[model samples]
Target: MAAWFLYREGHLFPCYFYQTTGFYCLGCGGSRAVLALMHGNFTDALRYNAFVILLLPFLAYFLLSMLIETICGRRILRRPKLPGWAWICFALVAAAFTILRNLPFMPRL
Candidate 1:
């Protein structure tokens, strides 16, 4: 449904952070990336937002695991508990991606 809306409407919403700061946020181009992925355009999706592309699998796994556990009253897969350092690393990666995507030398995300 979201992909359909994006297909019909072009863009879902402007990134207020980017608009105000003239800098791409971590979520910049995320919607377009999703739309591109839905259309089976892997390269375009990655170009739109490499961070989102790379993270989607983990996000999908987490959500699917949660849903499965909720519905079945047991986990189909073991839920891996991320340590504090892992979260910090993830945050650092996000910050780096945000900065890199906005760099003049980098391709537009």
Candidate 2:
């Protein structure tokens, strides 16, 4: 419903980080990407925010796993504790994506 409203409104609230820093942050275009995904427009969603599109499945899985565990009182999926190096790698990938998306030749996301 919120995605529908946002789509109908034709504008998303501007990203404060983008406004101040003149660069796309890791979360830039995330709302629009979600809206596009909700509408089943995978290409547009990826265009709006590839990072969000790529990460959403894992996020959804974890959320759903938690919900199921709460309802059934049994942990079906063991939540893995991410090691420090995994976190560091994730950060590096995010930083790289941020840089790549901000390149002049790249489309604004």
Candidate 3:
């Protein structure tokens, strides 16, 4: 799992999401954001999607929880979903990120 997470082929997927949908959705910046994160490029990641930079911890926690669940036949404590308020915050943040990144404000990636 770790190897799969870290390995790369230096190739881009078809990105059917963008090609078909025509709207750079919530996760459009994710791949670039993660690549920036791996290279210690905090500014670049934040520029791509500040929410991604901030949510990485929670994401890691969820992944680890899933791994634990698979390894041990039960969830350690039943990973709970974020509260409604957090969902609101996430929506707001994502909206702002998407608007900001897509605009001419971000010209250099």
Candidate 2 lDDT by residue in tens digits, 11-80: 5688999999999999998888988887889999999999988999899889898999999999998788
State the lDDT of candidate 3 residue by residue for 1-109, as single tens digits.
Answer: 4323533642234457778866566676666777777778899888766776788998888989999999998999568878999989878988887676667656644
Stretches of candidate 1 off by over 4 Å are 1-4
Cα displacement (angstroms), candidate 1, residue 76, comes to 2.8
Model 1 TM-score is 0.86
Best by TM-score: 1
TM-score of every model versus the real structure:
0.86, 0.82, 0.67
lDDT of 2 at 22: 97
- For model 1, what is the C-alpha lDDT against the true structure? 0.88
Give the RMSD in angstroms, all C-alphas superposed, for model 3.
Answer: 3.1
Worst 10 residues of 3 by lDDT: 3-12
Model 2 bad stretches (over 4 Å): 1-12
How many Å off is the CA of 40 in candidate 3?
2.8
What's the CA error at residue 97 for candidate 3, in Å?
1.9
In model 2, the Cα lDDT at residue 39 comes to 84
